[model samples]
Each structure stands twice: as C-alpha cells, then as structure tokens.
Target: MDAVQGTLDELGTPLSEVTFVVFDLETTGGSAAEHAITEIGAVKVRAGEIIGEFATLVDPGGPIPPFISVLTGITDAMVIAAPRIEAVLPAFLEFIKGTTLVAHNAGFDTGFVKAACAAHGYPPPVNPVVDTVDLARRVLTRDETPNCKLGTLAKLFRSGVEPCHRALQDARATVDVLHGLIERAGSFQVHTLEELKSFVRAPTPEQQRKRHLAESVPHSPGVYLFEDERGEVLYIGKSTNLRNRVRSYFTAGETRPRIREMIGIAERVRHIVCTTGLEAEVRELRLIGQAKPRYNRRSRFPEKVVWLKLTDEPFPRLSIVRDLKDDGAAYLGPFTSGRAADDARIALHEALPLRQCTQRLTERTRRAACVLAEMGRCGAPCEGRESPADYAVHVENARRAMLSDVGPVFTALEARMERLSVEQRYEEASVDRDRLAAYVRAAARMQHLSSLTTIPQMVAASPAFDGRWEIHVIRYGRLTAAGVMPRGAHPTPFVEALVATAETVRPGPGPIHAASAEETECILRWLESPGVRLVEVDGDWALPSGGAARHKARIEHAYRGLERRRAAEGRPLR
Candidate 1:
C-alpha cells in the first residue's frame, strides 16, 4: 500500500520538463487600451536550451511620444515600414502556443496581449503566465538584489546581455533572471512548475510544494492526518470528500492562520477511509483524543471535562468536578468548561437551597453557618438547622434535574426571572435567564446521551443516498462497527456478519460509557437523524416521559432567545 501511495503521488510537471516562452513587449504607453505595441520579442526554451527566437516591430498607427522614443531607441520612422499590430498578433500568439509565458512584470505585458486579442477578433491566449519579478521577490533576498527590476536582476545574475529598453534585449535579460529564480527555488524544494506557481501564490510556499501529498487520498468520506516527516500527527481532520478537503488547505479559502501553519509543517497526508460520514466523524474525534495532536484544538482533552456532581454527603451539595467515578453520586455533565458547570450549579442552587460551599458536610458535623444560610439560601445544614430527611428532598430533586427531568427547576427559575422583570431589574432577570439556559441545555444533553449509552448492544440503520441502507452496530454508546447494505441485500445476514465482527465494548461507568461524550454525541446525532430505524436492541431504547428531549422545543426556543440577546450585546452565543 505504501508503494502504491508513493507511486500515485508527485502528480506535478517538473520545471526541467516544461516548455517556456520568455517574452517582452515595448508599448507606446502604459495603458493597453490606449497604447499599441511598438515591438514584440520572445524566446522559446526547454531544459535550459533555447528552441527559437521571435522578434518583430509593429506600427502603432500613431506618433510615438518623445519620452517613449528617448526611453527606447525605436523612432517613428523605424516602425513605418514594420508590420501593423493586427497583422503581427496572430503569429506572436502562435509562436508562444503550448508553453508557459514568462516575462518581467508579466501583468503589464499580458494585459496588453489580452487587450490586443479582444480588439483584433482573436482569442486571448490561455497560457500560464510566470512573472519573473514575482518569482524574484519570493526566491531572492533583499541583500541579494536590493530590487527586482529586470535590469538590476540581470546585472546581479551576471546576464551576458543587459536590458537596453529594446524588446529583444530586455526579453533576453528576463530569461536569465527567470532561470536564476528557478534554480534558487529548487533549494526550497519547489522543483515542479505547479510548485513554482504555488510558491508565488501560496501564503506558505511549503504548502504548495507538498500539495502532491493529498494525491493519494481518495474522494470518499474519511479522516485525514497531516503528519510531519517524523511520522508524528500534526493535525487531524475529517470530511465527506477527503481529497477535496485535504486539497482545500492549500487553496485560498482556508484562511485560518493555525491551519496554514500546520500545512507548512506537514510532509504528507495520511487518510483512513470510512464507510459513512458519521463513522468518519466518530473516528476523527477518537483519534484526536487519543493522539492529542497539538494542531487539533477541540476534542483533544476529553478528560478535562467538568461534571456537576450531586455529592452523596449528609447534606448533598452541587459540586463541579473533573472526574466521574462509579460512586453513588449523580452527575450532570461532561461540560466542556468550568464556567458552564458553575452556571448549572448556580441555577440548581437558585431553585433549591442546596449548599454552594466546597466543604464536606456530615449529619453530625456541625460548623458555623455561612452567609448562604443567613440569606435563607441553604437550609443551614452545616449548623444542623435542617434535618437529614429535609436535605434528602433537595438531593433527590438535584438528581432528577440532572438525570431525568428539569421542567420544575426551569419553572422555578422562570418565575424568579419574571418577578425580577416586573420589578424592572432587567439585569437580574438576564442572569436568571442565562443560568436557566445552562441548566436546561446540560440536562437535555445528559438525557440524550444516557438514552443511547444505557443500551448494551444495538443495531440501527438509516437510508443511504443510494437505494441502500446505512447500518451501524453500537455497543455501550460506542460505534463498534459500521456497514452499508446494498439495495437488494438481505438484512439478517448482513446484520449478523456486522455484529459478529463488531468491536467488543465492556460497559463502563457514567452515561458516556466506553467513549467520550463527543463521540457518543456524534453517534446519537446520527441515530436521531431522519429515517433512522432500530433494527434490534438488547435493552430499552426509550427516553423518559419527563426527559429533556420531551422539552426539546422549549430548549431550542430558549437557545434562540439567548443567541439574539447575546448578539445584541456583542457577546458569543455559547
């Protein structure tokens, strides 16, 4: 496979194998629309050897300005007997056919050529234009030439002929500068004509030079890794079309600075083709978590997630923690940030008088009551004002809010926010709104994840783009195996084979067992997408009647409102 991949790469023309026509033009003035070509010169070359030379004088059908006559030795009388531009353009275009055009400051010369074609009923030449001036700027240092003017570069490169403002002389000098730049570019590993063009256009020349690394990637959906020369994964990504996505990093559309820097260091593109886009997404998340590639900002630290834990102490309090254990404590998250976990904890505290402190509490452990108790927030459990039975109610409510339902909790907060709004305390109302949103969203996610993770083993299918079925075998919320059934295939046999070969996942603790929350979330997303069907299940696959999924519309409505409010305040929505 490595041999095949190596053979399939390097799909670019080498500079030594390319034919080039180095051309220059002397015009009556700067603008092609108003000026006419007074002289045209070109040298066709291949492999550092000139194949042919073309030079001709053209009558402008107007008097030459004295300044232009002084710049070039050509006088009005010199072009009187020469061919007209209309008569000379056909042969000039033909002379440069089937070659890449090269010139100093090529835009000006090419602009004139294109204008001539448009005016004379001729098609504009489609040749790729290489500007030696641009190439010199990319390949040469300021100390090497000070400037990229044709005459200065010619002298710096020790060209045998110097540019004398005549078309043929300047063209010859530009050919030397082009050769010098190409040789200099080879030091940067830009040996191909495509690399040369990319070298000039790409923000990082290394990105263009390694473009062939994407050649071996297929057009199928998959995960791709940008690996450095040492075989270390620099960045990991996934796309529906691996080839196109990998190729896009080298194009103008990918403007992210970090990604461009990753492309510069990447030596090759390695890919794993998956059966479906969902599978690709799952693999990308898992790989990024495992590899912890420096270039991948998301999904690299799944363990760093914080959970809102309802501690099983005498007075169970809401505490934000990093690890989820097999203990009896109920957990609400998998929240990606501490601030979100804190928000959820505050929202619960607002509804129930759960203690907000970090100290461990006991049925008999008496301590000084904090301001929370004085403010009628907590039940003063630390000072033994509240009994175990009384606090148990808050503990059970917190568990219900975390695992099963959050409607009453949201209602309590909504009532508070409404009262605050009636008092014209808009800021206090907004705070309540945010805390409510945080708790509702976290509870909704927990329910969605728990619904899938509780199932031991399951087989599901969704309609594929073709007349086939996209089947997935899931175990403990992990995508153990994925396969596609052909249009007329037997479901039983196909599902049997897929299940037999599926990965074995022993159920682990927590709602997202044997997989990261992001991974399970990806699988759940696929399962909930339209047309998905549960082919078989070993256990219940139902969500609770009071689950957050039941209140999905309200959650969505709340989220949209939050987005609008934050947008008006110039803050991030999430």
Candidate 2:
C-alpha cells in the first residue's frame, strides 16, 4: 500500500494499516499475448473491512474455446453484449489505486492486465503486488496443504467463500486466504507489508527466533557480523542500513547456499554503525582481516601477501619477499601470488641489467661472474669487470625506473624487440614483447601508488543517495578513516573527529601485508571512480613525467594490433 513507503517507514508499517485489493481474472486462454481477459473481479479491504468492489465481464471479440466455456460457464453468447477489455481494464485499474494488489496466482492475472493496458495505449498501474501463492508457501508447510493451489489453500484455511472457477467468488476466496496467511505470519512478527512481501524467503524456525538479535542495530550505514553458536564469526558484510540488511539475512532474499548454511549456524547478528558508507567499507576490510571469518574469502590472510623488493646494495637486485621492513630499499607490490611477483621481477630485469644473481657483492668483491655476465646481459659487477662508477650509474637508472621514470627502460626493451623481429626470431620477439608489457604494467602501478603515498593527507568525497556524502581521509595511500555528512549538516565537525580517530598507518615498501594492499587499493579504486570529488589535499599528489603510464596507452594499442595480426595468420596464441 502507498508504494510500501521508503525503507525506514515500510519496516514499521503494521499489516492492519495496509490496504489490499484482492483481485481475480478468468481468461480466454493461458497466454495473455495470444488471448484476452473474459472477466475481472476485485475487492478492496482495509483493516478487515470492505471498502470497494469491482466486477466486469468482457467480450473476447472471438469465440471462446469449448473447454474454456465449460470451465468458466461464460460462452460467446453470454458475453456478446458485454463491454470489451479496453473499457473493463480502465475501471479495474481505477479500483485498485492506492492499494497493494493481491491475487491467487498474481503473475497470471497481472500479466494479462499489463498486456491489455499496452494494447489499448494506456499506462498500466504500478501498484505493489502480493501473491497469495507465495504467502501460502511461506506460511504453510506441504504437510499441512499438500500444495499451494488456490483451491487447496482455500479449503485448508476454511475460507467463507469457495472458489468455483468464477471471478468474484474466487476473488473473495483469495481475500480470506490473505487474512489467514496474515494471521499465521503474525507468529513470526511479520506485521508490516514489506515483511509480508518478503515472507517467501522466510527464515528457518531457528533464524526466525534469533530475529531479535538485529533489533538493536541502528538503521544506518555499518558493518554486520554473523556469528555461530560458539561465538566464532561466520561471515562479515557491510550495508547502508544495518537493521534492514541484517534482517534480510533471515529472509528468503539470502539465497546463496553457503549463506543459508551460515545463517543456519548463526546464533547472533552483531553490527558496527558508521557515519557513511565509505567508513563501513573500510571497517569491513579491517574486521574481515581481524576475524578471518570462515565465510570471508578476501583480505583474510594479510600475512601471506608477497612483495617485489629492490635490495639495498651497491649492485642492486630485485627479489620477492613476504615481509616489509623500515630499510631504505624500494618495493613494488603486494602481488596476489609469488608467480606474479616473479613475472614482474623478470620483466624489470629484461628492461634494466640489474643482476639476476642472488650473491651480495661489494666494490672489492672478486666472485666469478655468472653465465648472465658472460652474455654481457649484466654489467658484470660481481667480477669487478665494470668500474664502481659505471655500475653506480646503472643502479641509479634502475632505481629511477622502478620508482619514478621508466621511459629509458621501455625504449631499451622496444629496441631489443625490434632487433629480434628483424632477425626473424618471432618467438624471441614475442617473449621480449611480453616482458615489456609486464614491466610497463608493474611500473605504471608503482608510479600511481608512489604518487598517493607521497601525500601526507588527502580528503575525497562522493555523493550518495538521499543527499548524503561519503567522505574518506587517506594518509600514505591507506584509508586512515572515513565519515558521512548529511544533506544540510556541516562536515567540519565530522571531518575533525574522523581525522583524530584515524589509525596511523605507514605505507609499506609494497603493501607486504594484505590489509595494507587491500585498503590502499580500495581507496585508489574509489578515487578513480567517476563523480568522485577531491575535497582537500595537504600535499601535491602527482605522477612523474616520462613515467610508465604515459606509454601504457600506446603499448596497449600496439599489443592489440599484434594480436589481431597473429589471429589472422592462424598462429597459436600461446
């Protein structure tokens, strides 16, 4: 009734206050597209009292089938003088205005109504609809009714009116069925129209009993935790409305097999209300990492993240490490896997002649050079073949390639690929091309992250539904805290409180912790989203000139062209 109000009011509207128009239809055939409505009947009721009624018989414009005439007792001759659907549909639509429509098999009845409206150049009613079939399924078990067909439900509920394949009588029967189901739903505390509509996926008896667990949760943005009987967290989630979201878990709306099982074991639903959706998201990440809930698959193992670290040495080398330290070494990732970190390492080495060896060397070290040194692929620092000054220059170039500038490295890789291609070594050229692409991707990511990490503080905001703004305060690429400001409220107080309460997180060499990587990526993703406004920045956040990102577009275009040519030539893509 009344479009079910908004989320807040709908949850509290009692069933007694809801107005319903129970309707039924007898059709010429099964499909609305191929047939027409023969009869229509509806009864509007409020608080158990009849307020209005509508009944009509329509001329089908064609002969009724022999079987239909026997079932409904309405033949062509009986409806010859009756008005057509064009006239009956308008009257029926008016009768059900400002009310929720109820029918035995609602889809069947509403489908014909919508079809008739479209055929006649009239807009159909947009009333909230309820199906008695769905309500019966939720309120009555199969053991009680065998099936939820309108006839079976009518007999089970002992309705005053019995269905007889006639419109008005069947409509009246559905009204009684609606009341009976409403009375049974009361046992589950489903007093509101929204509750009734959502009853199809009613929680199991245990979940229904634990509905009180969400009673104290405020109707605001927040994170919710579902815990099993042993008080161990089972699943963690976020919502714009804590009460509504947590309550939905107990309804049929939660259809995931795993979620259903989680709710079966869940004994409590706990929540942490936030001022804005942004805060809720950040908190969800933190809680998921802390609790490591069995149902959470992401950001749960922060300790397992890997990083690509540039070792601090006279002759620098790249290595994959699992831990981040306070040392002065440069780093590039909390890559999802060790293989990815290795790929990035190989790509960087292909572009710059940073040694591929693991040995730690000094200016006076005298270890024999490895095979890579023999090929002139390395500067041969291990054998002291290259002077310290010359090797220092290579190390500086590699450092710049990793942290800021990457044009020279890309240029070198491109030259190597061209030379290989001219020599008719297509496969070798392909390998070098892949290495260049991988290095470019990793370099672009590092440059972007470096720009954000260099900033001391920054504030970003995005408009949300209902005139609310989601505000986020980021420090060193990590979201330190977040807040929400209402339509007319001043954001100054909220911003101050959030910044004061914000956690102090130092940027990792490469987000070695999953929590650090997950949070930073989350903030970066949001900042890149369309319509996100940068509200304030305490320091300059700018990417370096001649960085990897500058060439990424051109490289992608060329990559696509190469792929198309290989496809046309029927070459193996691998």
How many pairs of residues collide in each model?
Answer: 0, 1
lDDT of 1 by residue, 283-317 (tens): 99989989999877778988888899888777777
415-491: candidate 2 lDDT, tens digit per residue: 77666654656567666666666667777776777667767788888988788888888888777777667898788
Model 1: worst 10 consecutive residues (lDDT sum): 565-574
Candidate 2 has what TM-score?
0.54
Candidate 1 shows a clash count of 0
Q: Candidate 2's error at 128, in angstroms? A: 29
What are the TM-scores, per candidate, against the unseen true structure? 0.61, 0.54
> Looking at model 2, how many pairs of residues clash?
1
Give candidate 1's TM-score: 0.61
Give the range where candidate 2 is weakest over 10 consecutive residues by summed lDDT.
565-574
